[model samples]
Target: MPTSSRSSEGGTRRAAAAALLTPGLLALGVSFVVPLVWLARMSLNRTVGPAELQPDVSLSSYVDVLTDGFMWEVAWHTLWLGVLVTVLAVAVSYPIALFLARTRSRLRGLLMALAIAPLLTSSVVRTFGWLILLSDDGIVNSALSTLGIIGEPLTLTNNVTGVVIALVEIMMPYAILAMIAGFGRVSKDLEDAAGSLGAGRLRCFVRITFPLSLPGVLTGALMVFVLTVSAFITPRLMGGGRVFVIATEIYDQATTTLDWPRASALAVLLLLLFGVFLVLYQRLFRMVEGR
Candidate 1:
């Protein structure tokens, strides 16, 4: 072909690729970018009343959010809750994922089904189920009392502990699935070779299997952390309006107080904090990879 024809063909392909990507880009802008821009704008607006916000721009909302000791406490609670849920979900899912990855038995399918069964249910239903199970006079406390472990029912419901437990159940399936994918990518031959080199089962897993599975673990942890941090229904139900996270605070501001600017400000801050966490996580991953 002539050079001119070759150039024309390349241009055509580029145009085709751009055309294919245009719809997705437009959709993303409409669905995400526009809302984010609006939220940021609203955050800067001044709250004039319970039902009204003035269009005048100011940083008072953000200043209030940042300076208020209570808001800082809520932020800390949200961060720690996210971290705890991620850790618990990853820990509980790792062995299950390993089993699913290595097992060739018919039971593996049943086990996977069981793991994912909670996800098939509605979030409301799941949260209510947890409420039943964790209530002061509920099954957990009753069982403990029956076993003489406690003289009275413990305050498990409407607290951080209950929220963590519920969130863990909701997030565990995702963690397991991610880890299973990672574990599947690892070659069994590598593990066998480690064993042949006089490594015990635990040593082989630690040095060979676990390291190889880090990518999946990290991915799952990130997912769980984000979900936990953004969770509204589970925390609301499990915490019984007593445990206040950012999401709950946003809800109260938007609905109860009718302060759109304050709610928007909180939402923006939440996004910024998550953005910071993502950057730090990426840096940490890169450092681990470098080592």
Candidate 2:
């Protein structure tokens, strides 16, 4: 082919790729970039009163958010929620994901659906359901009492414990799906070969299968952590307003107090936290791939 023709073809392909990407880029800008920029600008403004803001630009909002002990507590609560829920969800989903990944039964599809069935319901509905279940006199406490597992009803609601439990359930399906994808690359043949070499089931799983599935585990953990950090519904309902998180704080600042600048500052902090985690995730991914 002539050099000019080759160059022309390359340019055409580049143009086609750029055209295809334009809509997605535009959507992303409208949905994410523009709002982020707006928030950053808003964060720099001064809050004059509820539902009122001043046009003056300053770092007072960010300074207040950073210096406020309450803000730190909320941030701690948010991080704690994210870590607990992510750990619990990933732990609970691991075996289920492994079973689904290895199973050859006719009901595999049904089983997979069942595993993820909770996702079909709205989070609000599910959170309400949790409210019923975790209430002091609710089914969980009643069952525990009846079974003699406890002498009295546990204080499960309006606390971090209840929120963690509910968030774990809400986040499990995501963790399971990520793990299932991770397990796809973990070959059963490797396990069988290890067994043939006189490795016990647990040994084979620990030495061979687990390492291969770490990518999924890491992916699921990262995803659940991020979701949990930003989650509002389950925490609000299950925590019964006793648990204050960054999300709830932001909501209250934005809506109740109408302190848009403060709310925007908190949001920017949350975004920074997410960026830090993403950087850590990339590093971890590199390490995993290196191994």
Candidate 3:
């Protein structure tokens, strides 16, 4: 083909791509950008009374949220929960993901379905189910007592422990899926070659498999962390009013206390927190990719 024809074709493809992307971009702007802008503006406004917002621009809301010790505690708790959930999810999902990635068993499809079946149910329903299972007199405690593993029923619900347990279960599927995708880049041939060179299974995995899988692990961790931080339902139900993370804090301010400005400020801070982590994730991802 002539250069002119090739250039024209390239330009046409570019135009078509842009045309296809326009709708999505516009939708994102309208749904996400507009609300974010409004929220930022709302955060600057003053709150006069219950459900009453003043039109004046001020940083008092942000200042107040920053100075509030309880808010700081909530923020710390949210971050801590994010970290804990991400760690546990990754730990629990890694072996499952590896098995799914490498196994050629006949039951692989069934096993994968079982692993992800929880996702098909409503989170509210799953959370309620957890409530039943983790309660003091629930099946878990009864079974543990039957096995003589414990002499007493454990306090699992209405606390951080219950929230952690539920969040780990909720986030594991996401981590597993991410890791499976990452493990796609790791070839069995590489492991075989390492073995041929006298590398033991454990050593080969530690040096080769795990390193290659970091991308997937990191991706899953980031996803779980973000989701865990913003999670409201599981935490709210599991915490039983004992746990107060950012999401719950925001809900209480916006609906219960009717303080829109404070809620908006908390929201803005959450966004900023997300931004910082995203930046760090990008840098670490680049380093892992050797870019």
Which pairs clash in the backbone of model 3?
none
> RMSD of candidate 3 to the true fold?
1.7
Let me know the TM-score candidate 1 reaches against the reference structure: 0.91
Q: lDDT per residue, candidate 2, 118-171, as tens digits?
A: 999999999889889989899999999999999978999999888888899999
Top lDDT prediction, candidate number: 3
Candidates arranged by lDDT, highest first: 3, 2, 1
lDDT of each: 0.90, 0.91, 0.92
Cα deviation of 262, candidate 2, in Å = 0.6
Stretches of candidate 1 above 4 Å error? 2-12, 106-110
What TM-score, over all chains together, does every model reach? 0.91, 0.95, 0.95
* Candidate 2, number of clashes: 0
**Candidate 3, 1-291: lDDT as tens digits:** 699999999999999999999999999999999999999999999998878889878999999999999999999999999999999999999999989988999999999998888889888898899999999999999999999999999999999999999999998888888788777667899999999999999999998888888888888889889999999999999999999999999999999999999999999999999999999988988887673
On a 0 to 100 scale, what is the lDDT of residue 158 in model 1?
A: 90
Model 3 / residue 161 / CA error / Å: 0.8
